[model samples]
Target chain A: MKIPLPARFRTPVLLMAGLTLLVALATAIGSEQLNFTLTEMLIRMIVVIGLYMFVGNSGIMSFGHIGFMGIGAYVTAWATLAPEWKQVMLQGLPAFLQEHTYPFPVAVLASGLVAAGVALILGAAIMRLNGLAASIATFAFLAIVYSVYSNWESVTGGTSSVIGIPTVVGPWTAVAFACLAVVAAYAFQVSRYGLMLRASRDDEVAAQSSSVDIVRVRLVAFVCSAFLVGMGGALYAHFLGVLTTDAFYLALSFVTLSMLVVGGIGSLTGAVAGTLAVTLIVEILRACERGFALGGAQISLPRGSQEIGLGLALALVLIFRPAGISRSREL
Target chain B: MVDPLLRVPQPTAAELAAEGVSVRFQGLAALSEVNLTLLRGEIVGLIGPNGAGKTTLINCLTGFQRPTTGRVALAREDTAGWNPARFRKAGVARTFQAGRLFRDMTVAENVEVTGVGLGLDRKSAHSVAMEVLDWLGIADKAARTAGTLDYTDERRVGIARALVLPPAFILMDEPAAGMSDSEGEDLVGLVTSIPTKFGCGVLIIEHNMRVIMNVSHRLYVLDGGRTVAQGTPAEVQANPAVISAYLGADV
Candidate 1:
C-alpha cells in the first residue's frame, strides 16, 4: 500500500489551497466593503510572511523590518509619482530622480531591489552580533532610518509626507502578491539554506562546528525578507495613494511583529493568521469607535486603541501559548 | 619486527597542532600552555577529569574560543586567526557533547545541511545525507526530527552530521557521555574506524574510560589544565601520572 502524505505537509497544502480559493472568491463576488478589507489583510499577510523569513528562520527578533518598508515606500513613491506632482510635493529634487517616472510594476521591482541592497549592507554589520545585542543593534538601525526619513526634506519629503502615489495595488493584486509571498517563504523554509539558518538558530556551537556560515545564511534571509517587505510597502503606498516615513515607524513594526508573535513565530500560516486577525480586530475597533455614541454624552475612546489591544493580545499569547497560536506547527 | 633503534624521520607537517594554547576565564586557567600534535590518519583521545581542559581545548581548536596564548595550526597552516566557519571550510568538523542536533530538523535534513555547507548541490547532498544516515544505521529515522530520537540515536545522528562534510579532521566532544556500555562501545568502534574508513584524523574528548581505552590509538590525559600523560592506551594507563590523576591518593 502507498503511504499517505504526512500530516505536516497535508495540513499546509489543504489550508493554503482553501485560503487561496477564499481570497479569490472574496475578491470576485464580495461587496467593495469586504473586498477592501480582504485586500488590506492580504497585503499585511505578505508583510508578515516577509517578517517570518528572517525572524522565524534565524530565531532572531528584529525591530528593523519597518526600516526596509520605509525604504520601499519612499522608492515606490518617488518612482510612480508624476513628475509635475512630485515637484509640487518634493520641491527641490535631484535632476535624475525628478526626470524619471517608472511604471507601477517597475516601481515595485525597484522598491524590492533598493530594500534588498540596503539589507545587504545592514545585514553584514548586524548579523555579526548575537542574541539581544543583535536585537538592540537592529532596533537602533530602525530608529536611525526613521529619524532620517523624518528629517530628509528633499528626497523623502520630510515629515510632511509624500502624496499622489499611483493606485496600482488593488484587491486582486494584493491576493496575488500574498500567495507569492507564501510560496516564497515556504520554499525558503524547506531549502538547504533555510535548514542551515534554523540549525544556527537552534544550536550555534553545533552549527559552527558543522561549518555552517551562520552570518551568510542570516544575510540571505534578511535580504529576501527585506525584498518581500519592500514589495508589500510599495503595494501599501499605491493602495493608500500616499507615503510617509511615519507610515513605517516603530508602531507599524510592533503591529507586524505582534501579528507574527500572536499567530506563531516560526510558521507561515501563523503569519497569515496573525495578520488577518490583527487587521480584523483593528477594523472592528475602528467601527466601534465610530458607531458608539452613548446618550449624547460623546464618550469617545482614544485613537490607536487597536495598538493597545494588539499589545495586550501579544502579551497574553506569549504568556499563555508561549509558542504563539500555532505553536511550532504551520496553519 | 621493527628495529627498535631505527628512527623514523619527522613528517614535513603536523596534521593538527596546538602550541602553548591557553584559555583563561576570569583568572582561572581552563587550559594552560597545552601542546598537542596529531598526525594524519590518527585517532587521539583526550581524557580528563571534570574540570580538566578537554572541552576548552576542543573549543579553542574549533575557533569557538580564542586562546589567551599560543597558536593552533591545521596541516601546519595557522588556524589561530580562523573563525569557526573558516576552520570548518578548511577541513575541520566537530560534534558536541550531549549531541547538539538541530531539534526542529529531520535527521537527513541535519546531514544535508552539513553536505551543503561542504559545497554539494541539493540533489547530491540529499543522496549523500541518506548514504551517511544509512551507514550510521539511522536511515529509517531520516524522516524523523532529531529531537524525537533517543540519546543513542541522537549521538549517531550527530556523528552522521559531522561525517557528512568529510572534513580532514573531526573533533568530537564527549561522544559517549550519556550512552550505555554497549552503545558507548558501538560509538568507540565507529570513531576508531573513521580514520581508516574516511581517511580523516579524529580527536575525541571523552570521559568514558572504556571508550578512550578502546578507540584511541594515542591518548592524552589532562588534569588541572595540564597534560598529565600522553602515550598508547596501555602505556598511558600504566603511567604513574595517569593512575594518580584517576585514582587520586587512593592509588
Candidate 2:
C-alpha cells in the first residue's frame, strides 16, 4: 500500500512543484530580455518568504526584516569588492576589510550569519512586546540601521553608494536560492517550534497552559527569517552590480510586506503569488509610464505611485479577502 | 446516610499535586492558599460558581498562570514556573472553556498541533491525531476546517486535540458549557475513559451538575476560591455546605 502524505505537507509539496514549474518557464521563455527581472523577482520572493516565516506563523508583523536585508547587502558589498577598488572607494576602511575579497558564496553566507546574529540580539527585546508595539519597535530598528548606513560613509560608501561588485546572481542562482528558501520555510512551518508559534497565535492562554514558550518560538522564527532575507539581499546586491543603502530602505520593506499581505499572510503559496503579482504589476506600470506619454507630456506617474498602488492593494485585500488570495493553501 | 466528606477517596501516588498554590493578579487573589490533588486513573470534578477561582487554579496547574506561592508538581517535577511548552513536554495538556480550535486549520490539523511537543515525527504525530479523531468518532470530519464544525463536533475536536498528546495530566476547563445534554454525556464519556484508555490523570472544571455527578470519581466544590466540600456524588448531593452554596440556604 502506498503511504499517503500528511495533510499539512500536501499543500506545500504542490506549491513547491508549482514554483519549480514557474522557475523552469522563466528560464525557458525569458532566455535574455526577462532573465534579469525574473532573477530579481525570485530573489525578492526569498525575502518575502522569510518574512512569512515569522509574520505568517506567529501572526506578528515585523519591520526589521529589511534592516537585516540592508545588513546583508552591505556585508556582501564589503566582502566581495576587490581590495584595490575598496581602497579607493573606502579610503578610511580598516586594513582587513580593504585587503581581502572573498568568493561570492562565502560573502553571502557571512551576510546571513551577521544578519541572524543581529536578529538574535534585536528579537530578544522586540519579541517580548506584541502587536503594534513590536511592529513599531521593528520599524524603529530599520530606521536606526538606515541612519547608520547613511552616516557611516567610509566603510559603507555612505550615501554615495558602492560600485564594481561582480554580477554573479543569474537566473539559476536566484531560482536555486528561492527554492531553498521555500523548502526552509516549509520545513519550519511543520516543525515543533512553528507549531508552538501558531498555537500561541491561535490562543495565547491555552498555548501557555500547554507549556509553549511564545517568546522563544517567535525569536527562532525571527532569526531564521532574518537569515534567509539577508541571503536574498546579498543576492540582490550582487545581481544589480551596485550597492546602496537606498536600495534597502523603507520602500523595499513596504514592498515585501505588501507581497506577504496580498498573497496570503500565513500560506507559502501566498508569498509566491504576492511576490510575482506585485513584481509584475510594478514592472508593467513602469513599462506603461515609459511607453506612453500622457497628453504630449512625458508620462510621470508621480515619484512613489508604485508604493501608493501597493498600499491601496494591501488595504483592498485586507478589507475584502482578509485571509489573502490563496487563503486555503500553504504555498 | 453517608457522610459527604467520607465518601471521596484520597489521591493516589500517580496523581497531580499542588501545595499552598496561590495566584495573585495586581494584589487581587485569584487562588489563595489552594491545595488540591488529582489522582491518576480517576476523574476529579472541580465545581464552583463564576469567578470562584476554578479556572485560575487550572491555569496555574497547566502553566498558564504562575502561582505566587507554593508549587505544582506533576508526576514528580516542580512545575511552578514552567511555561506551556515545557508543561506539554512534561506530559500535561489542557482544553479551553470556549473550545479554542485553530480556526484556519482542519480538524485533523487541530489534533496534529496537540501532538507537537510529544517528540513524535510529523508522520507519526499525524497518525496519532487521526487515531484520536477516530476514537472520538469524529474521523469523518477530519478534512473540515475547525471553524465550520458544529458545536458538538468542535467540542469533540477539542477533546481530540488534548488526547492526541497522550498527556499524563489533562486539565479541562468547562467542557460542557454550551453543549446539549446528549453532547455533554458524550463528552463526559470520552473524558471518563481517558484515564483507563490512555493511562492519564484528569482534572476537569465543570458547571454541568449532571455531567459532573455522572462522570467524576470524586468532586471538589469551590466557593470564593476555597474548597467548600469534597466527596462522592451521593455525599456531595447530601452535603449541606455544597447545597447551600449551589441553591442558597432557603432549603
Candidate 3:
C-alpha cells in the first residue's frame, strides 16, 4: 500500500547501472574505434530513450522529436562557439549572442532549456490534437524546424555545417548523459503523473472519467522528452565537432525510431538494447563493406548493405515479435 | 433595511439533477426532455429496451455528451457543459457499459490510477487500490493485466475502479449484461451494498429486470427516448404504460 519509492525505481536504476558498467568495460578493453562507436551508440540510446518517454507512455508516435534535437544543437552552438567564429559563421545571430561564449556544461543545460521552451510552446497546442492528427502536427513541427534552420543563412550558415565546435564529449560523457536520461525516464515512468498518463494512453475516456488531465499529462511528457533529446543533440554536436541541422533530421530520426521499435518501444531497456543492437549491426555491416578477410580470402559485402540489412532485420523482428524484444517489460 | 448577511449550512448529502435534458444528432432525437435525480446514499435504476437512449442518458449525466437542452446540476450548481474530468472532480464517477480498463496496466494499477487522478498521493492511492481489490475479493488478481481478466473479473475491476474515487455519485452502464443468473445475483449483492458501504449514490442502467428489481430503491423506465414511468418496482410492474413499453400495447 505504501508504493515504496526505492522498490519502484529498482528496475530502472539497475538498468542504468548495468548500461554504465557495460560502457565503462567497453571503453577499457575495446579499441579506440570501438570507444567511438560505443559513444555514438550511447548518445543514440539517450535520444531513443527520450523518444520512448513520450511515445511509449502517451501511445503517440512522434515524428518530430528530432526537431528538438536540432534546436538543442543550434542553441549549444550558439552558446559555446568562439566569439570570433560566431561572428564569421553565424553573422545572423544578434550581437549579444555572437559576442558571448559559455562553458560546456552551461551550453548543454541551456540547450535542454531552449529545446524544452520550444516544446512547451508547441505542445500547448499540439497536445490538444489526438491520433494521426497529432502525429501530423508533430511532423509539421519537424518540417518547420528543418526549413527555418536550413534556410536561415546568417545564423545557421544556410545548409553549411557550423564548424569549430570543441570536441569535448567522449565515451564517458555519453555514458553519463545516457545514464541520466535513463534515470529521468525511469523516474517519470514510476511517478504518479506517469501512471496517470499511461492510463490515459490505454483509454482516454476512462482516464478523463477518472479526472486525469490528458492534455496536461501529455505536455509534461513532451517537454521532458524534448529536454533530454535536446541534451543528446548537444552531446552530438560536441562529439562531431560540427553542428548541422541535417544531423538531427530525417535520417537520424528514422534510425533512432527504428532502434526504439526493434528494442521494444514499450520500455527503457528496449530503448538502450535497440540502440546497441542496431548500432552494432550497422557497424558490422559497414565492416563487411570494408572487405574483412575470412578464411584467408577477402570477403566484401555489397555497398548499402547496412541499410538493407537493418531494414530486413527490423521487418523480421516485427513480424516475429510485434511488441519488440522486451514487450514492455522493464530490465 | 435589515442586514441580509447570513451563512447557509452545507447540504447533508450531494445531489445530481438533470432538468429537461435532451440530446439530438443532426435531425434525429436520441433523448427528449429526460429528467433524473441521484442523491448520495441512494440506488436508482434506469431501465429500457434496446436503443431507448439509456446510454445516451448516462453519457449526458457523466458529462461525456452535452444535452442540447436542459441543465445537469451538481448539488445546486448547473454543470451542463462541463467536461468528463470536471464531472469526475465534482465527485461523479461511472463505469463503462463494457469495462474499458487500462489494458496495459495491472488490475491494481487500473484502480490506483483513478485514486491518483482524484488527487490522492501514491501511498494513499495504493492503499485505496488494494482496499478496493480486497473488498471485491479479487486481491490475488491485482498484478494481472486488466485486459486479460475474464468477463466477471473485468466487471468487478470496473466497479473497483469507480469505487476508488470515493465518489458521491456513480453511474453504471449495463453492469450485468452477459452475466449468468448466479452472477447477476452476486452483482445484486454488490450493487445493493454500494450505497451503504461506500456512501455514494448509484444510477445503474440495466436491461435485466431481475437485477434491477432486486437492487434498486426506485426505478425510472424509458421508452423511445422518453420516460414512461417511475416508481417502486411493484408499482412500475403494475403500470400499464410500463407494461406496454416493454411488451406492446394492444393493437
Q: Each model's DockQ?
A: 0.60, 0.40, 0.78
lDDT of 3 by residue, B1-251 (tens): 32111121112338998889889999799999999988899899999889989999999988999999987888888885689988887788899987999999999999988778877766667777899899889999998999899989999999999887468888999887888988967876888888888889999988778778878888999988998999888998899998888756762
Better of 2 and 3 by DockQ: 3
Error in Å for residue A277 of model 3: 1.3
Among these predictions, the greatest DockQ belongs to 3
Candidate 1 on A35-135: residue-level lDDT in tens? 77887778878888999999999999999888888888888888888899877777667766687898989999999999999999999998999978888
Model 1's TM-score against the true structure: 0.91
Residue-level lDDT for B174 in candidate 3? 84
Clashing pairs for model 3 are none
Residue-level error in angstroms, candidate 3, position A132: 1.3
Write down the lDDT that model 3 would get: 0.87
Best by TM-score: 3
Give all candidates' CA lDDT scores: 0.83, 0.82, 0.87
- Cα error, residue B4 of model 2, in Å, equals 46
For every model in order, what is the number of clashing pairs?
A: 0, 9, 0
Model 3 spans with C-alpha error above 4 angstroms: A1-7, A294-297, B1-13, B249-251
lDDT for each residue of candidate 2 in B1-251, tens digit (9 for 90 to 100): 65322332322337577788887889887787888888777888999889889988887877777888889987666875577767766667788888988887778777776565444555566777888889989888888988899888887888887776567778888887788778788778878889999888899987878878988888888887777888888899899999899657786
Worst 10 residues of 2 chain B by lDDT: B3-12
